[model samples]
Target: MMRPHRGLDPGSVWAQRLRQLEQRLRTKEERIVVLETENALLHLKLAEYQGLAGRSTNEVLQLYAAHGQQMKLQRSSAVTQLHGAIKRLKQDLKSLRSFALELSKDFQRQSKTCLYQVLAAVQGIQLQNEAMQMFQIKAFDLEQCLQEVTERYEKEKQKRKALHNNLIELRGNIRVHCRIRPLLPFDDSAGHSVSQDRRRNFSEKVAYAADDETVLVKCSRPGHASVNKTFQFERVYNDLESQDAVFADVAPLLTSLLDGYNVCIMAYGQTGSGKTYTMLGPQFDGNLAFSIEEESELGIIPRATQEVFRLISEKPPGSYWVEVSVVEVYNNEIFDLLAKDSYGKVFGIKRDVVTTREGKSDVPLLTHETVENASEFLHLVNKGLQLRVTHPTLVHAHSSRSHLVVTLTITTVVFGDNFGTSWEDEQTSQRLNKEASCTFPQKMRDSKSTSSSRASSPVQLEATEKMKQVKTRLQLVDLAGSECVGMSGVTGAALRETSFINRSLSALADVLGAIAEQRSHVPYRNSKLTHLLQDSVGGDAKLLVMLCISPGQKYLTESLQSLGFGTRARQVQRGQVKKKTFPVPSKGK
Candidate 1:
């Protein structure tokens, strides 16, 4: 027995306490029932006595009331009995309350222990729920990030797809043609004498003489015969057939203008060359001549107009009307030839700065007119040319002191098989496409028109909304000839003219040089001529440079320089033409 003694087990100890609490609870219940029974007996006797006093019989009832009153006095004993029972009940209730207090203390201790255990379990469950929620939130955030990445990738793919579809190339076969001027009555020997006389006076003759040298002139067309001669250069290209051949290669492009493609044709050469004659036929009217009757008379401008008309005629009548804007870049200024303004003043140049599909700003919009035929177009162009300032130099007569730009703005509408509606109003149709005319800075219009001519007339230029519809510019440029300052012996105002001419021509050369070397920055903004031709030379315009040469050995150096310019121009590759579709206005503002 003394070997080992086990401490009280937790389970047995709890069971013993529960049993003791149950015994005390039973005794309190029995005592409460006894006290309640005694109180009820005393209350019943008091009620009986009161009822006897309220009876209906007079004397007998009064006596019965006195008897009831005595019984009531005797009933006072019930109060003593009630007090004794209450005292006993109070004693039992005190014992029961003491026991209950002890039991409550034990219950409190057990409850505290149970609550701690429950709190620990609940805490573990809450931690698990929080971790699950955090994981779900992280998963949702990752899903959203993946979706955004996919959307960005899709947008980039669409941009690439659009770029892939807009690629275009020069689609025609390349051909080279030369136009020969007709022979003049002045023999080669006579021309040489006159050259010698001019040279002796100026003392500015070239080292090589025109003794055995000959000029080969050919028509621009396929079947025309070449004229070979050992004479002056100007006399060689004087024929109509020869001039026609010069513009033959560009006929297809001119036709496309009427078909809604902006086309530009430019000529570049030295002074005294056949550029003017080639572009504008030397004013000739041989309607009575039998040889001219069967043949198509071609001057570059006239032929171009005819071609435009031909293409437009293939469609319905009045379907296409060409608007022309003839402007000149004189010295370093822009002059609207068709403008009725003062000599030194001209209309401002405006262009819509648009972003092409390639995200480039090479496209420009120009303002122009709707011309009916070649004759009407020529009238406008001639008016502009007449307004231009020309001067005579010792080397050449009526030398163009500035660059001439002729913009043929062609607009074609597809009518709904109703010619009446088409011709009724030009503003009715929605603008489908827009072509830019030559984009020059408006500031260039401030330059003087001539050394002596004053700004007399005010510009009465009328603008058409149709001009805003042109997105592509068809620029035909005839640049002023580069001259040797020393040889020209220019002085006074002529000196200023010579300087401007040199500087501008030099700038043009620089641009060509930079472009030839693939320089990122070409100085097109340096000169007005360059700025006006910005579209044709560097923008999305297709350019053609015709280097007119004098085969005379006397002009060999100048001719070589002109050829060098053409070679440089050929190296420039301005991506491709970006065609823009004009959105139909809800209501034009």
Candidate 2:
């Protein structure tokens, strides 16, 4: 497996190696000749070095002798200088010893002062440490208390959810929040354009907020017995309370609509008692325009719309949809203010309301305008408000002849999912008013059955029920102010309008009385107003009756009546509050 290269043979390799050796021998001989020449040069240099070395030794001896003499002279001079320096150093040492002794005495005195100060500082630091320890102990206790509170809150989370953001009045009861409207100058038979002094003299305030939950009505005449009645409500706002303060209590209910509860907030008051001002803002004048400054004066409606949309904005995209229906109960007949003509113009359409099988009142074929934001909702509301029936009466210059009911219908959907009815308590009283049942499914069945000419499979109906959208209603009712005919000085149609308003309000009162009495047959159909509000009052809906009161002696009688109505509403024990949820549909459909 091994092979020699082309020039390779043992003999040739040996001859090549010998030639290389001969070349190396010639190079060695040349090197030896160079070495011999170098040796001769080195011998000459060594002889020269010996002669130079001898001369250098002699010169070194001469230099050493000369240096020894100079050293002796320098040593003598250095010894003399050392003696002088030693004497001076001895004297300087003595002076330094005395100065150090003086410094030691001063240091001892200064150290005494410094030591006392240091001790005081140490004492102060010790006190501070003790205070710090006490503070730490207190902080620990507070932390423990906070932790306990958190635990308690976690334990009661369910019960608290019924409250829904500490709105305690929402607990299955009609919360009566009394608002004592301030005594404006226009509260007299004369126009409101008067001097400040005249306005003050005309105050004659009989009704006022006594406290946060009490309304005081004190009326004293020289010839009559004094009357002072104190009534308790959920919240009582003074005449001085701002619109924001009044709505703060109401704002909580708006969000509950999204949580699956039908919420109704009604303003109950007499004519010219600031009911409209409390429900809406101040009346629009010529331009129907207001500034951002007036935004503070906006009442529950605009603000509530804003808050609802704001809450909706926080939800998932397209999770919730809002539709608005503006209805006015005029002349005991309901008119849809938001109704649109075929020409795309809005006008009042006389609409009829019927009770749902679930005992909830709903208008059939009513116009519900879907709104995107607060501005659109308010635009629609403004358009509807323009169609409201108003007449210049002796009592109110701009008296609303009809009850304006603005309902915001909130519809939300979840595909292929079930809405839980866990909030429906098992021990809930059977005697309770018609609860807002799991009715979206009922609605689906009603729809499926009504559309049923042909037979469909169970799976199809189930899909329909699942795909059904659940909606809740937020009913904001601004009732027509109750007024006396003789005092109002009305004639002709004014009298007729007054008669209808009084009758509808009386019918509302009668319904409340029936509910309070727990009568078997509630006369909800007696009046359009009553029939329309049947579900809100009788059903498990959040009903907040904001009783607006005039703070002047002029309106004392009407205020008392309104206050009594609110009291009766509060007394209506219709059982616990429940959500109008979409329960699982029955299979019978």
Candidate 3:
């Protein structure tokens, strides 16, 4: 009733408008509540995502820290090991450097001694003053005097004679020979440029020659053939047949030495020749391919063993034995190739002890032992090869940096007094009728005979006593290749090595020259190599020299020099005496 009368009441109309405003306000409140609820839900979801993201970030940081720690630990450990290895390597280098220095000093000393000795040979130079006599007249007189001295020296020495006499199969002795061949084209070929293509072609030719030689060696039997008897048989070598032949001819003698005689076989050559191939061979391609363990590839040492066994097989057991000693001369120093001491250092051979009259004690003093077969000898030979030092050069692919010496010692013993005497053991007692009454030193030493009858049995007793201690030594030497300084392209250490090599070779040449001219004072102690080879050259051991030559034209000069050395070597004369003792075997006894 009041609303119907609102036209008259202003307060009633205002109240109605207020009620309409209240209804609209209620709608807006509802909208605001909905929006607040949605905002609260969104805030809760954001809080949950933030918590997960914070956890993930913490985990990643922890992982990075662990990884960094691990990397740091690894780096520390690697540094430790590297330091240790470097320290060890540095020590080894230091030792090697010291050794090199010592060798250099020794070489210089030897050179000085050689120079003095050579100068001593011409003593008359000091006698004539430069102003007193004509230089030409003095020279002529000196030359004439030298010639007279030479003639007298040649005529005076009947005691020392080179025993090249090969033992006949029945005599049980050894023979030594030298075989020289024509030069090769690549022997002296050197330089880095491709212009040295000729070397390649020659190498191919050598390879072809090696193949052919292999065929020849393969055709022969192990013990019966010469090829199998001498070479290393490891590799088929090109143009080494002459060496093989030399070995074959010496097999019987080597057997005798093993049976109780001393023998020495050496291969001498300039770089690029077949010395290595002749001695070492390629790798079991020749006679080595054919046989069993006992008779496998008759290399020089193996063949010698077989021959020794053959001789021993015919002899009474326990009557004969053999041993070997191996050594190397590196830059004039002696290194025991067969020594088991890994910590040992190589030492120089003293010049005083290594003289011609007094051999080197450091050259490996061999002890006597018993060897049963060829396999044992091969084992020792292989050991020596392992101990030898080899390097590569422009002249030689596998150049021997040292002088390798393999000495075999043979000892014979008669344990029982009841040994049967036959024609083989009987002494030929031919007496000198002219000197029948003279008492020789041998006769004086024999107590079995009376002083009155001592002269009658002198020859037989001396021969018998000589036969009692039938000991022999065999030497197999592989000398480092001699190379020219210019051709070798040497520098620094290499240069020093070349100089040493040249000086040593020159000393050797001087010694040979003295021997060829029959000089009274032969400078055998001038170089370590000569001193070490005293027994082989001037002592009891038989000497066999193989002068290897390169067929290449480039090597003509070296080849000629090698041949000249061979000629001089052949002219050298030596004495015959029984070996003092048996060489110790490289293998552990």
Candidate 1: misplaced stretches above 4 Å? 1-241, 284-298, 341-367, 414-472, 580-589
Model 1 C-alpha lDDT per residue in residues 1-589, reported as the tens digit of each score: 0111256443344445555555655665565556555555544544553353234234344554778866555445554564566566557656655665676676667556655545554565578578979999999999999899999888986676335323322421111122322322221222233576544322322222132122332212236763333222111222344554456556756644543445567776766666776676565331213257333444577667667667666654433445566666665766655443366344444232333464333214333444566666666566667666667765566777777888765543332232223422444432222211122123323321221111111111123233322233466676777777654545788767767877887888788777667687888878877766665566555455555665444454565566556555655555555343342221223
Error of 3 at 309 (Å): 2.8
What is the Cα-based lDDT of residue 119 in candidate 3?
A: 48
Cα lDDT for residue 246, candidate 3: 44
State the local distance difference test value for candidate 2: 0.73
In angstroms, what RMSD does candidate 3 have relative to the true structure? 41.3
* Top of the candidates by lDDT: 2
Q: For residues 1-589, could you state the per-residue lDDT of candidate 3 as single tens digits?
A: 1221433443444356555645655655565566556556555655564565465456545654777766556555654664565566556556655655665566566556544543443332344344346777888899999999988876653222222142211222222233333444434355666365655543322211333112121122225742311222112334545434545656756554643446777777887676665565544222333445423324465455566677767654444455656677777666655554346433222222233223433332332223456566666566567667766777776677777777665544421232223212523112221122232344323322121112112222232332332445677777788888777676787677666666777777787687667688877778877777765565565566766666554554575577567666755554444534432221121
Q: Which regions of candidate 3 deviate over 4 angstroms?
A: 1-189, 194-244, 255-261, 284-298, 342-370, 414-468, 575-589
**Lowest summed lDDT window (length 10), candidate 2:** 448-457
Per-residue alpha-carbon lDDT of model 2 for 73-95, expressed as tens digits? Answer: 65556546645655565565555
Q: What's the candidate order when arranged by decreasing TM-score?
A: 2, 3, 1
Residue pairs with colliding backbones in model 2 are 438-583
TM-score of predicted structure 3 = 0.49
TM-score versus the correct structure, for each prediction: 0.49, 0.63, 0.49
